[model samples]
Target: MSGVSGFDIFWLIFMIMMMQPILRQKFLEAARQRMIRKLEQKRKSRVILLVHRQETMSLLGFPIMRFIDVNDSEQVIRAIHMTDPDVPIDIILHTPGGLVLASLQIAKALKRHKAKTTAFVPHYAMSGGTLIALAADEIVMDEHAVLGPVDPQVGQFPAASLVKVRQTKPLDKIDDETLILADVAEKALNQMEYNLEELLNGRFPEEKVKELAKLLSQGRWTHDYPITFDEAKALGLPVSNNMPEEIYELMSLFPQPMRQQPSVEFAPSPRRTPPRGNGKSLI
Candidate 1:
């Protein structure tokens, strides 16, 4: 047999390089499934994750933002349907929000589940993510995690602002397009408020439901305003700060697309304080 040529060696190296990413992805996926199984076994509940992150294309090296869409709603709803009615459900939400219609579909499906439903926010869940969180019977968040307002947006403008403009501006001064947008905005606002009320009705008192519905859907705050744990409690949401350690571990598995240099870094292990009166530090 002839000895391996230089060209053959180059081709072998090239093939291994190409296969590396595929093998890595498979390993990561297996690890995630194992984590999910462990969590389910520990909590005796079904686990569903609605995580959205920037996905980088391997060839183009461009990032694409993922969000809740019709496809996401379909898969989530299918998961809910496949689950037994008596089993509790835990939703791990991590998104900057997405389509209102898609979010509503997911919210309704989760609300219809017979057993208790919980939403866990390890970071921020804004806009439409907030809408889905509202449907859960309980919301569990990390101490520093945040939720956001669910105000409706029409195109690039807030529905509340559009409606305000139509009300304040003279009929002759307002353009036809502006008037049309205002009309649509009013309708969207009403629909959102109604749906929000419906989701919150049984969980809170009727008066409290109406108040929360109007407050969240009226665009009182900017779209991305972070509602901290204290604020959420003040607002009477059934939110708790007792987050599970497994949740943080699961989030680590869904790493953001790679970058040349990471923006933030810290020691991976937990820190412990030295014993009282001891001169030495504890590692």
Candidate 2:
């Protein structure tokens, strides 16, 4: 037999390099599934995850930002349908939010589930993500995790802002296009406020429900404002800071798409205190 040539070795190396990403992806998927199964067993609930992150394309290395969309809603709803009606459901949410229609669809489906539902936030669930979390009976978050306002956005302007412009500006000064957008903005605000009230209705006093709905949907804060754990509690949400350790472990598996150099780095293990008068410690 002829000995392998340098050209053959080069091709072999190239093939292995091409296969590496595929194999890594498969391994991550399997790890995530195993973690989900373990969580389900531990909590006796159906586990679902609605995680969105920027992922890089393997060929072009261009980053694509993910969000809640119709497809995501469909898959989540299907998962809920597959689950037994009596079984509790737990959804882990980590997203920067997405389409209002998709978020509402998910929220309504979760609301209709007969069994108790929980939303877990290891980092943040913002905008539309907050909308879905509100549908859950309980929201579990890491101490620093956050939820954001659900105020609707119309084009580049906030719906509430557009409505304010209509209210504060003279009709003669407003352009035809501005008037039209303001009209749409008014409708969007009203629809979002109504939806929020509906979600909070049975869970809180009628008056409190209305209050929360208005506060969340009326653009009282910036669209990206973070409502911390304490603030959420103050706002009368069903929020807690008892996040599970396993959740953090699972999130690690879904790392941000690789960059030439990572933006953040640290020792991966917890540090232990040294004994009195001793300098040595475990990490």
The estimated TM-scores of all candidates read 0.94, 0.94
> Candidate 2's residue-wise lDDT over 1-283, tens digit each?
9999999999999888777777777888999999999999999999999999875436434567899999999999999999999999999999999999999999999999999999999999999999999999999988899999999999999999999999999999999999999999999999999999998879999999999999999999999999999999999999998888889999998878877898999999899994585666656
Q: How many backbone clashes does candidate 1 have?
A: 0
> What lDDT would each prediction earn against the true structure?
0.92, 0.93
TM-score of 2: 0.94
Model 2 worst lDDT window (10 residues): 54-63
Q: Please provide, for model 1 over 1-283, each residue's C-alpha lDDT reduced to its tens digit, 9 standing for 90 to 100.
A: 9999999999999888777666766787899999999999999999999999875435444567898999999999999999999999999999999999999999999999999999999998999999999999999988899999999999999999999999998989999999999999999999999999989979999999999999999989999899998899999999999899999999998777787899989999999994586676566
- RMSD to the true structure for each prediction, in A, is 2.0, 2.2
Clashing pairs in 1: none
The best candidate in terms of lDDT? 2
After TM-score superposition, the amount by which residue 99's alpha carbon in candidate 1 deviates from its true location, in angstroms, is 0.6
